[model samples]
Target: MGETNDVTALVAEVEEQERELVLTRFTHDDAWQLGCLLVELAVERRLAVTVDVRKGPQQVFHAALEGTTPDNDSWVQRKVRVVERFGASSFLTGLRARAKGQDFNAQHQLPLQEFAAHGGAFPVRVAGVGIVGVVTVSGLPQAEDHALVVEALRIHAAGGA
Candidate 1:
């Protein structure tokens, strides 16, 4: 079915993004760089956006571009919760739940007030270790949100500065 294929492709994309977007080491400096890149890309795209990078409970870098509201910040929090809980991209969590014919909320029982399975948050994975932090962007369409994060991470991984 079309929906099945779409889910499959989405899952593939999530996996590919995870595979390619890796950090040798994630530090406060790296978080700042990634967050600034997210803001720059959002500005270039004319998108009202908020970016958050966190290592556990410590906030590393956070920014809200022009046109973004407090709600965008809230979404960033929620989406990052998804990445924190799932150890995967928020988009992947949603797509995997859909593929299983279950709603993410129903399956996870995580409060909507604190968690979202929307796109734009990715686990900050370090090679040979695991997820160390999260990088999140909010205020775009779900797919576009996911794409923007992936692109920024790709650039960061490729030594863009």
Candidate 2:
């Protein structure tokens, strides 16, 4: 019962974040800035991670910090695929699946190799344009990865970055 309440609260929180983080517009420059902001935050915290920003199918920015490997990059790709396919944060998708007592892969029939429902990938939604891209980070625990991206997005949305 407590676990179910936790999941419910988490789902609500993530959904609120998705609703609140919508951008007015997302351009190439915006992608670059957001990506750099993610890098800066990770560096300041001494986090080992890979960050990626994409506009549709085009990747605009990517960075692999110290201690990250090619596997982190692969994780970025998989999480990005989840955000792109589901039009939501990967964390949210996974949480929703868990709330329903289902395996994300089995429920969606998406192969794990190409699509992951783990955290750290978020939709870059524009106010009038909907989801135009995704911003992803990998290397931390799934929840921490998601929180890092959310923190960056919150800063970016508030014009702090």
Candidate 3:
């Protein structure tokens, strides 16, 4: 919840973060590494969630942590759909719409049944290429979910475990 300008700034910041946080190479190993990092972070924080890394429609890695349910998995799908459709982070997409005094469903005429502009999913971009996948977390507050994924991506981008 922010002012219009704040939301606009958030979208810009996320876009810059995504633009800079690209992988030199993205293999199955990279996906596994990123996915595992999300799970580990969630566990350490006692968060009940589902984390998924997917290439297009193919899930590369996924885990439902303790206390998570099937509903969280559905959230992952919804959030990822926003990222896939917009080619941006779900949080950013949501913020952009909000800044325009609209939501994705109302502004874009997208179905809420099919898409969610939640803040948990981010595009997985590879250097010199465009977004090839999405990494998502669900079950926490939207900002927390988004932060967890972004932090993991940052660590991965910096070549950390």
Which one is best on TM-score?
2
Q: How well does each candidate superpose onto the true structure, as a TM-score?
A: 0.95, 0.97, 0.95
lDDT of 1: 0.88
Give the TM-score (vs. native) of candidate 1: 0.95
Q: Which residue pairs does candidate 3 place in steric collision?
A: none
Tens-digit lDDT string for candidate 1 (104-123): 98898888878889898989
Candidates sorted by TM-score, descending order?
A: 2, 1, 3
Pairs clashing within candidate 2: none
Worst 10-residue lDDT window, candidate 2: 152-161
Off by over 4 Å in 2: none
| Whole-structure CA lDDT of model 2 | 0.94
User: How many clashes would you count in candidate 3?
Assistant: 0
Model 2 lDDT tens row, 1-161: 88888999999999999999998888899899999999999999999999999988899999999999999999999999898888899999999999988999999998999999999999999998899999999999999999999999888888887
Give the top-scoring candidate (lDDT): 2
Model 3: ten consecutive residues of lowest lDDT:
1-10
Clashing pairs counted in every model: 0, 0, 0
